[model samples]
Target: MTGGSAGAAAGAPWAEFGRRLRSLRRAAGLTQLQLGLRVGYHHSAVSKLEAGLREPPVGLVRRLDAVLETDGELAAILAEPREVPRRTGRFPADP
Candidate 1:
């Protein structure tokens, strides 16, 4: 992939993921308290996740997907780790 594409594919950080979660919740017309009740978490937990203070766990992601009827996008996003390029060889300056 081109550098730009590769970077884009690297998966979003926790903060962006949180924002997406919050947006999805809002689009579903659910408040944090209501969403948290559906997902079996506290309201503060949902708030922290939406605020980017905590990353959602896999179970939470799955619950969110089901609750929002997102057809698994949220679950898929949570499954991937942030991608990074692998180093193939030592630097030329290495002895």
Candidate 2:
């Protein structure tokens, strides 16, 4: 998950996104099961999303944002495009 460029940072955006989602849910005092029930997803599905193992649907993101009263931060984060690092098959120090 390391990016060749120092500015890019390691880990997938979705992984970080999932962490944010989990934090939001925790701050709102909602358990994964409860959030899933409110958002029309299974508990496991919510767990996966919060774990950054799965990409949530747009509808789910909207529902989560509304339910958590996050003022659209969650939705905005979910909507962001994730950039994969480009590999040129060269060593980092190669010129």
Candidate 3:
């Protein structure tokens, strides 16, 4: 994986992380809507996050860890090296 297409290839990790988040949410018996509500985001936000179309905000990730009862799992995922807004345009705003 190199050059132009390498960009897409690089997304695999985040995509997989999204999958894990989906599984965790489901195991907790929460729908995307439910999770989003808990995290103060729209259901579509959850969908995009789960679909890897957007990067999870750091705060959202922490909220999810609490909402989904993952006890830091989601936050741990956020800590991993991944492209931020510079490349993905989905980073959390500075606060």
Candidate 4:
């Protein structure tokens, strides 16, 4: 449960990352739209990232860590060992 990978047991890395992001954003008293503005993304993009419907880019994740004052907790979730699902075609589905 250390290293901030505790969410791994709950679900996929991206999902876990989203969960953490949502929690941190709330703790910082920011709405998704506000967070998106601070991170240079649209509110819908923040919504997608929080819903785990999209994998966030590394730079964004780092920005989130800084914005949320996590001191690297968010980044540690990405460092956890896990099999990330890959899209195979034009129309792809998550595993």
User: For every model shown, what is its TM-score relative to the native structure?
Assistant: 0.69, 0.74, 0.70, 0.73
Runs of candidate 2 exceeding 4 Å displacement: 1-10, 87-95
Best model per TM-score:
2
How far out, in Å, is residue 47 in model 1? 0.7
lDDT of 1: 0.79
User: How many collisions per candidate?
Assistant: 0, 0, 0, 0
- What TM-score would candidate 3 get against the native? 0.70
Question: Which ranges in model 4 have alpha carbons more than 4 Å from their true place?
Answer: 1-13, 84-95
Each candidate's lDDT (Cα)?
A: 0.79, 0.78, 0.79, 0.82
Q: How close is candidate 4 to the true structure, as a TM-score?
A: 0.73
Name the regions of candidate 1 deviating beyond 4 angstroms: 1-12, 83-95
Which of 1 and 2 is the better model by lDDT? Answer: 1
Candidate 1 per-residue lDDT over residues 4-86, each given as its tens digit:
64355335366666777889999999999999999999999997776666768888888899999999988777677776678
Tens-digit lDDT string for candidate 4 (1-95): 24444443346447878888889999999999999999999989987777666788999999999988999998899888888677776865588
Candidate 3 runs further than 4 Å off: 1-13, 82-95
lDDT of the structure predicted as candidate 2: 0.78
Clashes of 4: 0
**For model 3, what is the alpha-carbon lDDT of residue 70?**
87
Location of the lowest summed lDDT over 10 successive residues in candidate 4: 1-10
31: Cα error in model 4, Å: 0.2
Tens digit per residue, CA lDDT, model 2, 50-73 = 666777788888888899998898
Q: Write the number of the candidate with greater lDDT, choosing between 2 and 3.
A: 3
